[model samples]
Target chain A: MSLREACECISDGDVLAIGGLTIHRKPMSMLHELIRLGRRGLSLLVFGGGPDVDLLIASGMVGSLDAAYVGFEILGFAPNFRSAVERGEIKFTEHTEYSIMAGLQANLLNAEFIPSRLLLGTDVLKSLGYKTFKSPLTGEALVAYPRITPDVALLHVQRCDEYGNAKVDGVLAIDLLLAKSSRRVILTSEKIVSAGEVAGSPFEVNLPSTFVDMVVESPLGAHPTSCYPYYTYDLWHMISYLEYCRRGMVNDYLRKYVAGVESFESYLDLVGEDALSRIMI
Target chain B: MAPWTTDELMIVCMAREVENGDIMAQGLTTPMAIIAYYLAKATHAPEASIMQLAGNIMVYFDEPPQASILYNEYRAMEHAVHIFGQNEVYETIFKRADSIVEFFRPGQIDKFGNTNNSTVKAGRTVRLPGGFGIPDASPLYKKTLIYCPRHERRVFVERVDHVGGLGLNLGGATSGGREIRIISELGVFRVDGRSGGMRLMSLHPGVDVEDVLSNTGFELSIPENIPETPPPTSVDLRLIREKIDPLNIRRLEFLSGDDRLEALQKILDEELRIWRSSNVNRPKAQQML
Candidate 1:
């Protein structure tokens, strides 16, 4: 299916849960589509933070972003996120990676909330609006994170078949949980194989066809970000992108590439052939 | 007479804490702890291993991995086992894992060693990056050690405003804090038995006992026989300066020394990228079904 068609499932008020580690396999193609479509007031839940979050916030798409660490590693601060938080443009709340994991885990566990000891005594509970109750059996304090079943989950996978059986190559890095927990799962794949090829693998299929609502073949989808087995993260692009952010011209970048380009293919073209070829591992 | 840079001194003190066969984990932000984690493995604790964030690269360094740690580009990516898509991280590395060492350099740390990397002011809410790990699986780890470069009153506060990480007050198994060790540029501190709070274990060179006392917001325990921090032996200094860290990216740990060091790292990293892509046959990430 086309990315534009896939984006139809997402509405303006939909809460999105993005899958990726820092600079890793994020659903950039669909996120760009969402931004391009000018979807507003998105409440987001993400595990690890990266350029994708920065892009979303800079585009004024995020109403409230719930995440753990949102800064670019070694590339300095997340200028758009920090400035927006300071300007009161986005309501920012912090979650430790584990607590966010617990929030997602609750959905798959078929429970009201996931009980964990991690957030207790930490302001993460109070700030993120978690509840704590005494365990009647042991009389021990337990922190309960409300099950956050996102309106939609956008995931980028290494490969998937026509039947929607998907495989993610690298650190499951909470990608599996993100896939399973959300209400609707949208997958963008670098390669689309036959169901025979998908079913032919010996490894566990982390994201099954049952959970997937849409599969869009978007090659080089996680540009400037690493898609394990496909390419390494584009350090040059990331560095240049941060320089633009530092200048407070994230919008300028969006205009030139993200907003300016007619589509994902055009954006990749603007990224240029040399830049794309260089990052491949 | 030879002297050690504060970075060298802190690294040495931190290295002493790692015992043999201890599994260690430190992210990109904690460069000081990263060096110590590598130094211990290279010098004394050969049996020990380390885990990078996202489980991307698990490697031992005979020398400081300047590009690998700083730019997140090891160039040796193929040799590194990619653990992505494997549900083993949360299952084995975090929750069900055995004893491991968690290293952090928190933005705001209180007297009890509780850490806050969430917000600077409770009202303005200047959001720092949230706490990364340990909060997820704090109990499963054997030891939680802190390494902060700055030793100021604001950092060592009466109490942290937001407890993103646990300390003497909240890290215990009962969902309360257990004893934690803190290694900083100024000195070493451990949870004291008397008050269940942090106390000065030893003072580093050029850092007086009064300097620590004055900087700390809470009263610190003056142990009966407080010893001066053990300076890095000449041999270890040679290894760290000459052998281990060729690029000297470790200097970026200090504020005054950071800008230039980081610039050099970026340049070296760019150059390495060019060289690596041209010469090496970079391995693709294994696609495990």
Candidate 2:
């Protein structure tokens, strides 16, 4: 299936999850396309936060966010998410920084919930409506975070074939687990090589085509973004978005990037080659 | 122009050293040094070397300046130099500087140079503007200079509520030898070469030794006769009022509650305005020159 068709499958109020943290090989083009298509009311579930989340939230398409550590580094704080929360515009399920990954790990393992030691003597867990369970032996109370299984998992990869056999060079476990756990998986790739290229090296395939429901040929897809080994990140944009979010300008951001674009082509045009050059692997 | 404020005086003292190619780092009260460093380059120290936490030699402009001058490059320039953490620069470069400048409120500092920008004694917790790589960088620098306005016992305590960065221990271990200075509105001080505690080097005019001793929690080592810190010179006052004061950067004091948020927003707005206006017409260079 085409990437757009896979994105089109997403209906309003669906739970969406994307892979990667803060510009390291995120499926950014696919995210931009998803926003350009005007998919709204999304409950975004992710372990860590970055520009992709910022863009989605700023577009006003994200109804709720559940994550940890969402901000641009030195540039500033996460203004969009902060503004949305401040204005009571979006519902949020804030979690301790560790629980986010643990929840995803729990889902990948098919556990009902994951136990965490984070938020002890802190109000974060209780305030987020998570329940605490006491250990049967030690009597130490542990916070249980429910497993998060998104309706769709969008991922960007370094290499893949039309058949959807994907290969990621580094950090395969998280993306692989996310693809396996999600209801549907979408793969955006830097290059669509022949299946024969990776036929002999099956272990190199991060996510086999069988797991990928859709595959999009998006060279430099992580443009104006980072995919480590491939290119350095566009730190300026990340910092700017973070500053904007810190200032509570999520709506303004959405108007400019997501909801503002008339079409996918326009969005692509706005991104320009500068962003594209960064991911030109 | 507005009259020269003491904050500018503090900047002039620090800037003179930075202008001489001395590596400098500062803790939370870095605004004065930040403006001073930049202004010094424009006016006096054109050839001075400056870098940020990431080892990149760029200046950054944020609501609260993050690390060294390099972070400012992100705000001043249009293109981004994609890096991981914001404090990465300070962690790498500022930690190993030849000199550092730290500023604190009266009640926040302890004797060992641990600065508590967070909470006072009570259950009341005041979250600081996040740690800016000081914990790692403090101990490694060759020299550390602390700045404060009010000289009271609460300010010059024997120990701080929290150590923002490492203190005299860093100075003691300096392979090339380190110097630590404490500059305030009232006077200047240096750690006693023998005792490792702060000793009165000089006092500002109108400031008496009793006032200094009374406010300090620890006993101050006094020389026979301490000289007075020179009054702000005409050039110093001119630079402070005309060049730095016009920006009114000091109003960005990090307070708690809504005021903190508002001050942050204003700083951000000001930085963004400066960034946008400066680069609006500048053509993108083929390479970083």
Candidate 3:
């Protein structure tokens, strides 16, 4: 599939699950592409959350979000998420930071739901309308989080073949689970190679060809971000976003950078070579 | 020190001290105490105000802090408040509090009252709950209080695993000469200005000096004629159960790894026990609980 086909696969109201946390190995260019195409009311479910979710929420495209943690770590908080919640613009169904991951795990296992001990004592689960039931034999109260099966699983991979058999060298578990659980999988890769390149290392092939629905050869695909092994994270942009969030100019940020850009390439132009080069540094 | 029961005795001690208009902060295991402290302020210290990190104002006779209640009243309408992020409502209050009181489990708190809400060793073992901006908040307050239910030697140790937060530097430029107070079920202690060592302040009623000595890991200076903490009253207990418990405002009570079901059940059981024991004969406590 071409880049345009992969971009068009996302429709309205679809739960778009993205890979990576913060700036690490996220499909940012594709995300910007989806935003440029004006994808609205997409409920995003980010596992091990970060800026990808923040950018979506900030763009006013996200209707609902399910994740464990959704803030910029150490640098400060997620200002866009915070401001949105503060303004009552966004509606959130918060789960304990871990339960969000557990829900995805249950989806991979093909289970109906997963029981979690993370939401007890806090009002997070109850606020989400998750019921608590006591096990008859053990007398332990159980919090049942329904399986998270996304409409589409979008990820950026280090390498992939024409058929979409992909390999990600770092952090394989959650992305692999997402690939297995979602109905459709869209991959954006730094390089497109033959199956021969990936066949020698069965252990390193993160996503099998059968599971992939489409593949887009997106070199610098995780540009303005990082796909790990292939590139280091674009921290300068991340730090700039953090500073922008601190100033509470995130809405303006979305309008100018996220919404204003015509395409992912244009978005890359907005980031420019100097900023992108920092990731390499 | 043994866990202090939410009986009449502890309530009275907390009530007399917590005055109106005073910003009170507390840590884990003392959610009830923090609640009781606020209740006493409301009834006795009528001018006292209560602000919670969860974004609720503790009105005198209302339910405990529930996110749903807060969501409906303030969060829902405001729609802009980020509950868990830095620079949220909690950070605003944390910056403004005159007296900031926090509870510390030894494993999580460092020498300067810096807390570690992370896994013990970085990148090695279990990931503990991520730390809030406690380190930034700890050192900024006029007064910092550390409360503990367990008065073990390990808890009262010389240093903590990591400084999740940095308290007012006792001897540093930030100190501004403000001293930190450590309160436990066994006794209350303060950092000695000269040595930075823990020194005895007062003990809870019926607590022994030897027990305090035995449990503390570091050497402490004993003050002569240590005062006993007054017990909670019937009225104080009434306000706590009825008003505070129902809100469910307590954060950090259960360990991150504890079964959610069991932890919640234990909370329910404790609430029931408090109600059954204190409210039958005394109807007012029932109204409050």
- Native-referenced Cα lDDT, model 1: 0.74
- lDDT of each candidate versus the true structure: 0.74, 0.58, 0.57
* lDDT by residue (tens digit), candidate 1, A106-127: 8887988877666676677778
Q: Chain B TM-score, candidate 3?
A: 0.65
Model 3 segments more than 4 A misplaced: A116-118, A246-248, B1-289
Q: Native contacts recovered, in order, as a fraction for each?
A: 0.54, 0.00, 0.00
Residue A20 displacement in candidate 1 (angstroms): 0.4
Candidate 2 global TM-score: 0.51
Per-residue lDDT over B70-115 for candidate 1, one digit per residue giving the tens place of the 0 to 100 score:
2343332433444533245555565524456767787788877678
Point out where model 1 deviates above 4 Å.
B1-4, B54-90, B93-98, B122-124, B138-142, B170-177, B193-196, B210-217, B233-244, B255-274, B283-289
Please give the lDDT score for candidate 3. 0.57
Please give me the DockQ of candidate 3 compared with the native complex. Answer: 0.02
lDDT of 2 by residue, A34-103 (tens): 8778888999876445577767877768999876445443233455665566567888765533455456
Largest lDDT belongs to which candidate? Answer: 1
Tens digits of per-residue lDDT for model 3 on A185-267?
A: 99988888888776777875657888888888877777545554444555456767766776778877777777776667776
**What 10-residue stretch in candidate 2 chain A is worst by lDDT?**
A117-126
Q: Write the per-residue lDDT of candidate 3 for residues B1-289, one digit (tens) a residue.
A: 2333523343444445565656554322235455555565557655544443222222332233322211222212122222122123344454565644333333444344433443354344433333333433444555655555556765665554544444433222124565666666676667634545566777777889999888876567787878776565555555555554443433323223235334543553454344345533533212212
After the best TM-score superposition of candidate 1, give how far the Cα of residue B244 lies from its true spot, in angstroms: 4.8
